[model samples]
Target chain A: MIVAEHKPLKELLALVEGFDRILMVGCKGCVSVCNAGGQKEVAILAAALRIARKRAGRPIAIEELTLDRQCEPEFIEWLEEPVKKGGCQAVVSLACSIGPQYIAEAYPTLPVLPGLNTTFMGGTVTHGVWAEYCSSCGNCGIANFGGLCPVTRCAKQLLNGPCGGSVDGFCEISPETPCVWELIYERLKNLGQLDRLEAILAPKDWSTSLSGGPRKIVREDLIL
Target chain B: MSMKTNLKGILEGSGFAVLAAAPAVCGTDLSAVSDFARLLKGKVTAVFAADNPGARVSASALAVSVKLLAEGVEPVLCMTTRDRNRLALESDLLGAGALGIANVQIVNGAHPSLGSHPSAHRVYDVDAVQWIAAATRIASEKTLISGEAVSGDPSFFIGAAANPFVKTPELHLPVLKKKVAAGARFLVTAPVFDAARLATWLDNLKKSGVTCPVIATVAVLPDAATARHLARAGRGMAIPDSVIARIEKAGDKSLDEAIAVAVENIQAVKALPGIRGVAIIAPGSETAIPRVMEAI
Candidate 1:
């Protein structure tokens, strides 16, 4: 899931300071699951902004709304009714970065602002903890390393094996981070696939990854 | 044809090879190179120039290698994978070859987070083994990793780093063997403080069929404080407590004691099987190198 965190209240407040009234939009997708940009968070942010504005002696208004998913064009249309009625001068998106981009495209006249910082594509490690699991490198070759992606896990993204800095199964970067190559070695050894590592894994084709440039995909089968 | 001077030729000869690591060449000063050459001209085989030791930014190893070459000393240019991608690495190698710098040491550089610029992004486009293989291709096959032909020969006497202290030889040995297979002519190791561990690693190397000559590194600690720091820092390079205690007990003679310890390590490592030479690393100074070599 796409993980994100709320922007500092001060920064968000400054971003919307020019506008007396704004529409704060939230998402019910990954942002909601991560407890970052959801319906409850939207209400809290709206109330906080109201309080902050009222304290400044310039009481502003905010129309709060949460979409099923801001990334889909169909769900983005749901904002039309509230935005039309609220007379909101700007839109604030509390979803992952995708929400604001979609909202900006949908409502070109109003200024779109981001209320949260999109961090990484990751999954929840615990109830309140999240860890990055993939880098979306386009090419998936985890099967070669017992289902572990060194491209995302290893600090250096070493293809062949661990570097000399691996100490006691932990990376030299921090004791908290387990050296992923060591983990791969252990996993492969347990599976009796140690011989698989005998062959040197070649340098990755990074052009398939982010190194190539901004990426895009079009499915001919699904095209109109 | 190979370059006029190369580490492989020196190591392949009958005598025990001695590599003196020059102090970090952080600027345009070639006086250190001349001084180092004058001090160890007849005594050493090659001068090693490290790339960003401690991950702190320093002068290019190729630039230092050029200085060593000018002083009539063979230079081993240490190249790290952390700083540049395959294109830049290949370009540097080609440039080094043109400058008559033949010996190249490939290492997975220390993480940038551990360096002076902790927030700097690292480009490990190719790991050490992959780069070693790519370098070998650029040298021997006259082709790039992309299979592009070079206009001229860019030969190199390739070397790779080894860590004898890794707890998991199950994984380390295969990579070492692969490095040799990928055309690393020699293997230089991290500083060896534990002879037993080194011997075990050597035995494993032999059993794994990696017959490349191993050059053990022996670092000269200037004081007990540095020893304590290294031991506490936990950078994965081991410095035994006994050795640290010995240095600490020396009081004002800690520098001498450190040199003596390095001498002892050199002698001990030279006696072991598969050991071909020792690279003396005297941090912040090359004065200890001559003393360590003379004592050994």
Candidate 2:
């Protein structure tokens, strides 16, 4: 889901104060399901912005466009023609951190402000209900423990077992959440692979999914 | 999750009922206001204030309604904020509260075309949702136009309309959500003349995750056939084939069929998991609503 923290309305109002034509860009792919950067949210934000502006007596021109996904180059191109055509003073993006970077790089002269706080990758439970559940680390280790993730849960990313915080099968940090190692233990025990936890989990490999120069993936067969 | 304290919670032990008595046209005299209030004493009963400056049934019987509620009756104040400005709204709220009446329904109100004052200019500084928000902001924040908080807090049980049976169910859902977000505690729909349409609307509300208490409105007509001859300004109201068929079989001479139709719709709606209560609207047949309430 598009995991994003909503920007305060006052801050957004301040940003578009003098801009004649403002475009509020929204992302639909992940943020839509999470109820963050979707068409509905875009409409709400647009109306609120107009109302706020009207209340302030500015009454500036404003428009909204929600693209499929802002992170990809193909999707970001859809906005290039619209922005140029509208002569937009500024483009406020409602996508994650990666999205703004792409927009800025695509059009160096246009100013792009982000409308979401860019939270962690997560999923939805129901409409208006979203919960953070994963941290993509560009690794596949789920086979060892019945598909339960530990990188996002183990506090210390301890794949081996529980530290001292597992109290009555619950994590100490949050009373509602289950302990990572406890879940691992239960899953391993159920899968007839009880001996897997016996091996000490060494410090996890840190070569992938970290703050570095720039990350890229290679698909050798696609070039042909 | 939305905060609790819905209409059901308010009326469960308080003993109350709404009496929809909207006059078919304007300029109808309401000399029997106190009599209706007296009849509904120590129980929930309401009579619509006809769209007339000559008479407002609620205002006419304000003193009596107050006296009745003082004896443990719950008086609900219903006003559509179409032409009425903030001063009028505040007076109504304060006056009702002075009379121990707390329940209030905020409506965008009907246009003047429904009345003799069609030439009257519509005064809407804000719509129904904004009006309700103003009330909530006053009560919760304890302030007024100048950002000054009142010395004492205001207590109100506010409700708004939701037409789930409307063909544009999508628009209704968003509008209802907006109203709720703006601080409407419950929903009183336009009218439910059909059972299947009511069921469909209930299902759509559930799927849409609207948790507010909705009171399905069973319209009370002089007869079933007259009710079916609906015109514009209120369109897409769902009427069941079974109800229509029943009306056709009964021909023109059946007030019993209309009452039966209203009773059946009430029962059908209440069975929906999300539905909380029923609000009966009787345009000309104001007296019949209480009977349906008693039957239910």
Candidate 3:
């Protein structure tokens, strides 16, 4: 999932300072699961903004709306009616970076502010811990390393690893972090696929990654 | 047609394999690098291609290596694990092999954030040791990590970097062991400013059972700023107070002082055991090479 964290209150307050009324948009997407920009989080932010404005003697009005997903225009179109009726001047998007960008493009006349800093594509590791596990390089080679993605797992992103910096199965960067290559080596050893370690991985074809440009996929059959 | 034939006299006569260290190839003027290679010609055994020296991304080291090879100089490509992923690194190795480049120095590259592209995403997919191991596999198996076969005799002399002035040289011994175990044939120390400390570190390395031929680095520090810059550049590399004082006292004659220091360092390193050669690293002061070589 795309992970993100809320921007500081000071910055958000500064963003909507001149606006008399504003819309706070949330997403039921990755931001919701990460507890960053979900419905609950949007409400909390709206309440905080109200209290902050009241203290500042401004007492601005706010209209909170949670969208299914802010990235798609179909969900974004839901805001047109509410924004027109509510007399809101600006919008605050609590979703990942895509949400605010989509809202900005959808309603170019109004100012759209981002409420969260879009972080890496990651998953919840434990209860509150989230670890990044993929680089989204477009080319996937997890099967070669016993399903451990070196592009995301190894600090150096080396196709071959262990770096001699691993001690007691922990990475050299931090003792708390387990060396991913060590894990892969152990897994390969257990699977009796250690010979797979002998092959050299080639340099990636970067045309598939951001090296080329913004990437897009189109299915000819699905298109009208 | 043979490149090594021209290098035989210099390699045999000096009793030391001198490697001319090129500056970082990022945004490099290749013609200048080629000219420098031509200038040194038969004076050096090989030219070492450096990665982003100031942490700025530029042309790939493999690119520079090929250019040097074209100039009729044997090239040792420097591979930094900080930017390119495993796939890119292996491709570069194959490319180097195809170009008849035979030497590679593997080092954990400077973090991308440290360079001009501070916001750039870094890919430290593998550290230097793993890179060495991977390159070794490519040289021997002639295949890639994805179990794909590549056509090339990617045979290479692997090299790794060492820091003599590290906080504790003893602590870095394990890293050296890992580097050698990962298939590094030789080691290059960070530029030596303090000969006694380097001698002590060499003794410790020997005691730790590391028998790889070490190439001592000697840098020409033309000024106090250059001294400080090198010290900061190497990350924990020490510049002795006495050496700094000498450069400071030399005032306008700092270049001469740097030359004297480099010459003195070469002499001291030559007296030490286990050192196969001395690599002279002078960025803007290539003229000092001749003086240092004359002393040799």
Candidate 4:
């Protein structure tokens, strides 16, 4: 899922400056699952921002609301009433990076401020610990590496590793992070698929990735 | 067991010779390197290809090798898979070969984080072993591992590096085996400070059936400060305490002591059974090559 984290209160306060009334928008999709830009976090940020502004002798008003998902235009339409009718001059979007853009496009006049930093598309590895597992290279070939993604996991993104610097199954960058190739090796070894490590895969076609710029997809059969 | 007392003697009967590593830095003075290489033109066998030494990206090694080859000097190109993917590597192999550069050393290289551009994403699409495997395939079959046909065979004299000072150095035998099996024609070890450690490592390699020609590395530090810095920054270059004390006590003559120590190391390393030659790495002290080689 897309992962994001709330911006620091200091930065958030600086972003909403000059705005007397603010609407805090949250997302129930990826942000909610990651405990980052969810409804609960929106309330916490609203309260914190209010306290910070009040302490600064410039008390402001904030309204909290969450949508099913902020990236989609249909879900973004839900914020029209609060932004148009309510006294909100600006919106603080606590959703993935795409949220603020969608909100801005929906309410063109209202200032849409992003309250979260979109980190990566990853899953919660453990409680309160999130690790990036995919590079979203627009190509998925984890089946070849025993289900481990070197593009995101290896510090060097080595297609064939562990490099000479790997120590005790740990990456050279940090001991805390387990080397991805080491994990792949163990996984391949266990599955009796070590021979896959021998076959040199060709260089990745990065045109499908961000290198090729913004990507879009349309299914002809599914299209109206 | 002192086989040779000088560089000339060291290269007298062996297939290898002392090659100088011309490290490329952010603002590398290539003229100075060219001058150094010229000074050692006939004195040494060849100059090492600039493999982005010190992990800093500089002029391509192939460019340097081509330049040196034009000057009638052999160049050994160090190809680290850290910077390029398989396509770029194969291209470089073919390019180096076209430039008449034969020797190529494959290594996983230092992590890009250690280089000047720490933020640069490292592309280790293939490690040293896999890279060698591809190179060997390109040599015999004239085809890349991807089955892409090349115009001509690179037939590179494939070399790989090993660090005997790493933790439980003997355990690296399996890794050495993999490299040799992949395609390493010869091997070079990390700089030696403690000969005993390397001896044990070599013994283990032999026991494991490694018969490739092993070239020992002898790093020359100019002073105590350099020694300490290398010890801290280098991956497997641990300076022995005894050698450190000797350097510290030498005071104004520390460089002389370092050279003497390096010479002594060359002697000790040459005595080892499996070691076929020595490679000298004296970055700031390139002049010391003549001195060390004079006594090799």
Candidate 5:
């Protein structure tokens, strides 16, 4: 899932400062699951913005709405009616950067602002904790290392790692982060596949990753 | 014969090899290299041009290595996987070979976040072991990892870093063996503050069948404050409380005590069976290196 967090309130306040009225949009996708840009968060942010504006002698009107997901065109169409009603001069999207980008593409006249910063593609590790698990490098070879991805987990992203900096199974970057190579080594050892590590993995082909360019997917058979 | 063979000969020879580290060789001045070479001329074996010590950005170690070689000193260019991809690594190796810099120390560098640039993206395209393998293939096989022919002789006397201070040295054995298998001719342990710990690490290395020549590092602390700082930093570097206490208790003689401690460790390191040399790392006190070497 794409994890995101709210931009600072000051920054959000500045984004909608010039507008007399604005529509705040939220997404119920990964952001909602991470408790960042959910319906409840949208309402809370709207209230906070209104209060901060009112106290500053510049009370602004804001209409809050939450969509199923902001990345898709179908969910984005939901903002059409409210935007057409015409008092809304700007839009504050509480989804990942994709939502604001999508809104800007759909309604070219209005200024679409990002209310949250898209951090990483990650999953919930605990009740309210999330950690990055994938880099979306487009090349998946985690199976060889017993389902662990060094490209995403290791700080240096070395194919062969647990560099000399690995101390007590923890990464040199932080004590909280486990050395992924150590995890892979231990996992492969337990599975009796330690031989997998004996062969030096070749240098990664990063053309499949963001290094190539902005990526896209097209299925010829599914195209209408 | 290649410079790599000459270096290997020095390492395998009965005379103890003395490597002096010249950290952060990024400035416009080559005087530091000349001054260091002049100071250790007859006494030292090679000058190690470190790659971004403390993760701070510095000039390429190969460039510094070239400078050291020009100054009549053999150079050990420290190349880290932290900054370059395999192509760049190979290109640099080819360039180093062209310049006649023979010795190369491959290690996974310190994370950029630990350095001056915390926001910089890291490119650890290859790990240390894989890099050692790639370097060996480039040198001996005369082919790049992509199997393209390397034009010139890029032979390297390859060395890899080993952290002797890890609490459990046994867990580090497999990787050590893998490093040796990957063509690391020698192993350089992280700075040793405790000789007993180094002895234990050497014992473990011998038992694990890693009989390669080992160069142990000894950091010369100038005072109790630096000792405390190193102890607190703890990046797989072990500075036992007893060692720190000795420096602190020395009062006005803290600097002498620090040098004495380094001298003592160098002697103990030299006595170890698998040990080939001692690399003196005196971060800000390069002058103290001669004293340590003289005492050892």
Candidate 6:
């Protein structure tokens, strides 16, 4: 999931303060996991704004809605009649970066802005800590580095091997983070392929990762 | 008298900078005393992050950070809301006063993910600003959230973090002021470790009229291996080439120069008015803080 952070309250307030009737739409997928554009947070943001406006005595009319997924057309259709009926001036999306654009595309005239900063596609390290493991570089070079990624894990992104900075197996960045190369070294050492670095690896081909342009994946049979 | 002026002049000349200190532990200690010296040496204030230098931050680590203050290292006491619950927070604040760590930074830390217990309930009942508001009351010797009476007050220089780079960046300023209005006495930023980034962002904060203690952060990488890990963290952190070069040249050479870079960077940031302190984030180099302070 692409984990993200919500923009500060004041930033969100400034964004929507222009409109009286606002619809805060959230997603139940990816963002829900990251707790950004998820149901609970959208409710919280809406409640916060209501409390804030009421405190100041502005009392703007704000509506909250959450869909299974906002990036899809079906989920957006759920908002049309209600949002259109309620005369929502703007739709605040609590989904990933893509979901906002999708809403804008569907309702060209309707304004859409992100409520969360789409951070990265990462997995649960602990229950809550979600460190980024992939830059979505096109190539899945896991086989080369023994499941651990030197590209994403190493502080300097050293493709070759560990620098001298590894002390007792932890990266100098902090005591918490382990040396990525150390993980690689340990993995390779376990695999009995310690000489893999001796073969002289090539520089990372970043185009495959999601950095170059719009990225896509396909499985022909499953695609249809 | 002139000596004090000269020292103040020297301190003021250094500019805006902050020293990052987490609770010092056996592994992840936020060793405040050592960090206080770094702030003093760099002529920067310290925003002590509540971390256990020995390992993961436990209740015991906070106790250690508090005790260290007695060694004449009365620096700022900093923490994320997630680092401790309100109960623990209240306890630590009381302890900090006992140790004499007057300054404090409050933040809503990221909830533990990977290494954390998944089923643990998030106790963010209070956010950073509210926590500050609550803690500041303790400084006044008022009643606490638990309705407990204190012998004295919780005297503190409260602080918070402001993200300078955002859409409508100017808007964040008022929020910062709100935190200040609520209880915060200072503003410690997740400072742009990059000098260029720092200059532009500092300029923006200036335009916003947020004239609090805008203590800029000076993160110490001092090693290539650590720089790589920080790069992976991919937070807004910017690692300069000079830093990487310093690390590369560090080799078997005595880490004295590496440690010097840490202090020197703090010294450099002290020239900025907004940069009131340095957060000595030596990361794994918790013990190295004293050495860095020696040069400062």
Instruction: Tell me which of candidates 1 and 6 scores higher on TM-score.
Output: 1
Off by over 4 Å in 4: A9-14, A17-21, A47-61, A87-90, A104-111, A123-127, A137-148, A181-224, B1-14, B23-25, B85-91, B133-155, B165-178, B207-210, B222-234
Model 1, B1-296: lDDT tens per residue? 77646467777775578898887866777687678877887788898988988788877788778877777888899999999999899999999988878889999988999878999889999999999999998878899999999877677888999999988888888889889999898999989998778999999999888998999999998688888877666477899889999999999988889989998888889899988989999887577788899756
Best-to-worst order by DockQ is: 1, 5, 4, 3, 6, 2
Model 1 iRMS: 1.0
lDDT at B260, model 6: 66
Candidate achieving higher TM-score, 1 or 4 = 1
lDDT of 2 by residue, A180-204 (tens): 6677766776897866654433334
- List the pairs of residues colliding in candidate 1: none
Note the DockQ of each predicted structure. 0.72, 0.01, 0.13, 0.29, 0.59, 0.02
lDDT by residue for model 1 (A146-198), tens: 88989989998888888888888898888889999898998998898988788
What would the per-residue lDDT of candidate 4 be over residues A1-224, giving only the tens digit for each residue?
Answer: 99888898899999999988999999999999999988899999899999999999999899999999987888988887887778798999999989999888877787989999999989998999888988888999899889989888987776654555566556666668787777787788799997776565655667788777999988999977
Compose the digit string of candidate 6's lDDT tens values, residues B1-296.
Answer: 01112212323465433354643444444354455444444343443535432224444434544444444334455566544556788887787666556666776543343123534444444556567677777766565666688766446667777654332333234445556666775665653445555657677777756566666555556477667655544333455666667777768652565676666666666665566655566665655665665544
Q: What are the runs in model 5 whose C-alpha is more than 4 Å off?
A: B4-6, B168-170
- Measured with C-alpha atoms, the lDDT of residue B97 in candidate 1 is 88
Better candidate by lDDT, 1 or 4: 1
The DockQ score of candidate 1 comes to 0.72
Candidate 2, B183-279: lDDT as tens digits: 7877877677666777787788778777777776787556556556442223334555566667667876466687887887777776776666667
Q: lDDT of each structure?
A: 0.88, 0.63, 0.78, 0.79, 0.85, 0.63
Docking class of 4: acceptable
Question: Across the candidates, what are chain A's individual TM-scores?
Answer: 0.94, 0.88, 0.93, 0.96, 0.97, 0.89
On a 0 to 1 TM-score scale, where does candidate 5 land against the true structure? 0.95
- Superposed model 2: Cα runs more than 4 Å off: A1-224, B1-8, B11-31, B42-72, B229-236, B240-252
By TM-score: ranked, best first: 5, 1, 4, 3, 2, 6
Best by TM-score: 5
Q: Write the residue-wise lDDT of candidate 4 on B1-296 in tens digits.
A: 11122332343356556777764534545675676677788877667876887578788888777766666667778899888877899988888777667788899888877667788877776777778888878877889868988775455677898877655333345567778888787788878888898898888888879888888889788788878866655355668878988999999988889899999999888888888888888877877788888766
Residue pairs of candidate 4 with colliding backbone atoms: A158-B124, B5-B296, B6-B296
Worst 10 residues of 4 chain A by lDDT: A160-169
Instruction: Name the better of 2 and 5 by DockQ.
Output: 5
